[model samples]
Target: MDPVPLLQALIRCPSVTPADAGALSVLEAALQPLGFACTRLRFGPEGEEVENLFARRGTGSPHLCFAGHTDVVPPGDLASWTADPFAAEIRDGLVMGRGATDMKGGIAAWIAAIASLPRDLPGSLSLLITGDEEGPSVDGTVKVLSWMAENGQIPDVCVVGEPTSRAVLGDTIKIGRRGSLNAAITLHGVQGHAAYPQRADNPVHRLVRVLHRLTAQPLDSGSEWFEPSTLQVTSVDVGNPATNVIPGTARAKLNIRFNDLHSSTSLIALLRAALDAEEARYELDTVCSGESFLTSPGPFVDALVAATRAEAGVTPKLDTGGGTSDARFITRYCPVAELGAVGATMHKADESTPVEELRALARLYAGVIRRLTAG
Candidate 1:
């Protein structure tokens, strides 16, 4: 169960976002021979089908679930890649492809680690994998988690194999992540020729003022275990091609990465207040991807830190800085943390991981599994 071949197999699948592309089947073949009972879960509407897999070995207490996504983000501008994005090319001692680090490689490492464990050891072990982490994420881990809850498949603790290390493998363990909220605002006004400035109500002016109010102040001073929240204006568009006409509508999009101090509902209320003060007719839509969560330092985190120090020789730092991950969804069900390879290249052209690093990560994961399940 060398991770190299398994990672190569996974990377070869062009399972970008919602597409399965046989990625789960490849994982199933590998896990089945190792005594895992695998279940394929297909979720979402028919047109946007997403495939997920849940597999388990043993059926006792202290179930340790490994969660991740098999899908990779789209390989942008393939012509710029040194090799085929799905080739899993081994060059300069690195495995190169779309998902080499963003996650498929991490999944391979964990599976290989499981294969290394003694057959009779452990209370329970399971994998909750999905194909929608890189997309809208509506039909992936969230749905599988609901199914697990209904069927009593929830584990005692969970580890998400997202790329959390910033510089080297095991250097960081994400104890939590900030929540993400996306907002779109459209301001309605009257369109008029530039010569008739007094007749045209300028929605752009109003929209800019609203955006300024949102960004003018910090969301919060840094939280105890998390960084300060942030909001960025992603886009502001009038879509007016005519230089002489004032646009009738102005639209702006915003993305906020917030700490536990604020929930999406609270933030939405704050935004509404701002819009109300402007006295402008407008429409607003907000979508919350996840709420902020933290698994406070305790025995589970202690086990992971100890294992990482022993196996990778890094005193792993507990961090909460990063974009939202599936762990956000899992946090609702169980204490969860994130650990994996360095993510410096994830989602970029020529995304890759060194063979040596991949093997090392397998050993680290093995140590984590061994420590957490030890009697």
Candidate 2:
């Protein structure tokens, strides 16, 4: 199968976060040509549209699911690119586009891989393509997973086609991702004249103590497969124009990238305790996305490593170090792992993937499928 043409066709669509831009249609067209029955599902609040696709082939046991997104991040500063970001230019043997390495290429590879399978393949195969992975992500995979559960379409294993390869095309396959929690805290203080410092409760001083306490100590020494937990103060915004007046409120936002050493609840508890020590009137809100998960290098991960060695001539490292992806949502349903092409330039001005590697990925994925269904 010609994977380049399919990759080019996918990259040509400017489906930047939360937009379809004909990306899914291109995929459906390819899958339908290969005998996969397609279904388009949309779920979100009234007046909001979130597009998703669930396609399946064969009718038997041992179902295998492939999941990914068609959305690309914004092509920053179009002038910096050698060619148009969505033109899908093939220059110097590299396929250049916004989503070239991050994903469009991976989806194309999987399509080609399944196309190469026998026409009467055993077991079942499916695809879960979402359009909201790079956005707030409320309406894409989460909704589709629910729909699958309600409709009794959950698969036995899931392979997320995220760009997990680091230095090479098959150097790493991620078994899990560290969870992310973002929070904003506001400490209330008294607005008093600067001349009378003793009368006013200074929120800045209180918040400084709180932040220092939070950051002074490390969250952990580090887990086996994960790095040490980290919490960074992203922003401390007072928005106060007058320096002479003590502000009524001091606000700050922190971004925490934590590992399996701590749970979201435990971190929240620590935050509350810190606030209690400060005795400051404060309020906080937290958003948690996927606590750390591990698949334990079981049969699913072993198959992936074997396929990479056979097809790509390299042994892949089982990793859990990266920002969160849709794998977080898939982990709830079954054992899931992420393996794909080299992501040297995913969401940049001149994102690219070599043409040769794209074909190699197709072969690698085909081998994975064969190994999965051989038994």
lDDT of 2 by residue, 52-135 (tens): 999998767678899999988999898899888999999999998989988989999999999887977678999999999999
- Ten contiguous residues with the weakest lDDT in model 2: 366-375
Question: Which lDDT values do the candidates have, in the order given?
Answer: 0.94, 0.90
Among these predictions, the greatest lDDT belongs to 1
- Per-model TM-score on C-alpha atoms: 0.96, 0.98
Q: How displaced is residue 119 in candidate 2, in Å?
A: 2.2
lDDT of 1 by residue, 41-135 (tens): 98888877799999999999789999999999999997899899999999999999999998998999999999988987769999999999999
The residue pairs in collision within model 1 are none
Model 2, which residues run further than 4 Å from truth?
A: none
